[model samples]
Target: MASRTTQILEAAARLVARRGVRGLRVEELATEAGVSTGLIYYHFKDRTGILRHTLEFINDRAERYTTSHMADAAPLAPRAELEEVLLLELQDAPEVRENSAAWGELRASAVFDEVLREDLARATLVWAQEVAALLGRVTPMAPAPALAAAGERLTALLEGLSMRWLSGGLELGHARDLLLGAIDAELARLQGK
Candidate 1:
């Protein structure tokens, strides 16, 4: 069974995703979780605690999902490897999509909440590091600086694709093609060096 804290966090995340964080209330989250409002306070000291826990939970799941997808693949060329990883990242895991929406709502609310902003920045750094590691493994020919630059570019592309997909700005197929093409072009440029 899920712990009370986990249940509360999941409930809060769903509520925040559907209706901005500003609309989230402790009583509502507790009710959604099928617990008493006092139970929430028992698990979390306050609203900020709940939000922080939810962000950490989302980040942990993302790391696990990305790592699992990248592990145990057959060795391939840098271009092929990059394409594979991009495809995996671009495909929206339902859990991730919901968590991402919740995070987006938190991000907008974070403009006025320093704690939320800091939590988000920390989570972003963890994600960027994971992306950098994946890029580094593929770009062995490139120097550290060059590989790092590529990683940053790849991160940007992934983020952009995610935002576009979530906002219904682009179809998944189009985004995949665009990302694959960009990765292939970059790999070719590296190969020529």
Candidate 2:
């Protein structure tokens, strides 16, 4: 069973996924979490506090998910392992989809809310660096600058594709195909093939 704090954060993530940050209300969150507002405040202080913690919670979960998946993928080739990590955002599982939506909500809201920008940027940078590391593993001879550029491009594409998929603007299969195609193309270019 999840602790009260994790329960509240998970509820917050679900609300954020469905309604975005602007739609998240403490009372509704409390109700969804099956806890009192007092408990919510005790755990997180206020709505902003909740939002901040929720973002961190989501990022932390995503990192752990990727790490675990990558660990299980040790027998796979580097490119396959990279594909697994990149496709995580598009996974059909309910929790993965909800987390992707919540993260997307935070990323979109960060533009108008300066408080979220730093944390979102930090999360994005961490993801991009991970992508770069995977790219380095895939092509050890690639220059650092080139690997970083590829990472940034891939992450940017991922964000765009994920938003589209979440909004129903793109199909799941197409999103996966596009991402896999981009990965192949990027690796080919890196390899000078």
Candidate 3:
């Protein structure tokens, strides 16, 4: 039940994920979404508009997905919430895998594109803040340096491990274990244990 804009965004995301942004063409995107090139321009204005909207579309989807999952598990303990949030990153479903790959592609593309760089940095910052809040809630310390450092560490581990997972180098269960282990170790360090 997605709208036309969502349909176009999804198509564009798949194309970008598969071939990178440099490979995206209006005709190809139109054909992929079963819309005319005019419709694409009408919805997004131009190539840059389409690209910006596509990135925002993907970011919004991630935020919604994370929010939904976190909300569903809100009754759980702080550690469980932390586990749910981080483990949600490694989804085995086809759509999730596509999005994960697309995310990696977008992150890579952002290095050379200033606009994308800003957007991607904003997305990462939001996610990191969420992780920091979770770390603060789960750890013995307050939302101070301990939580900030632990959250950053967890975010780095998630990004690195997500790359490995997306490349088929790690399974979801293994990634979950590794994340939990890291979280536990980080908590221990925070507690001076």
TM-score of 3: 0.83
Predictions in order: lDDT: 0.71, 0.86, 0.81
Query: Stretches of candidate 3 above 4 Å error?
Result: 1-3, 23-25
The worst-scoring run of ten residues by lDDT in candidate 1 lies at 58-67
TM-score of every model versus the real structure: 0.76, 0.88, 0.83
User: Residue-wise lDDT of candidate 3 within 1-193, one digit each (tens)?
Assistant: 9899999999999897777778889899999999999999889889989988887778777766655665664688988888878877777877877777778877876787787777677777777778888877876556477777778889888888888987779987898799989988988787773
Q: Supply the global lDDT for candidate 2.
A: 0.86
Worst 10 residues of 3 by lDDT: 65-74
Best by TM-score: 2
TM-score of 1: 0.76
Give a tens-digit lDDT track for model 2, residues 10-40.
8988988878888999999999999888898
Deviation of model 1 at 28, angstroms: 3.6
Ranking by lDDT: 2, 3, 1
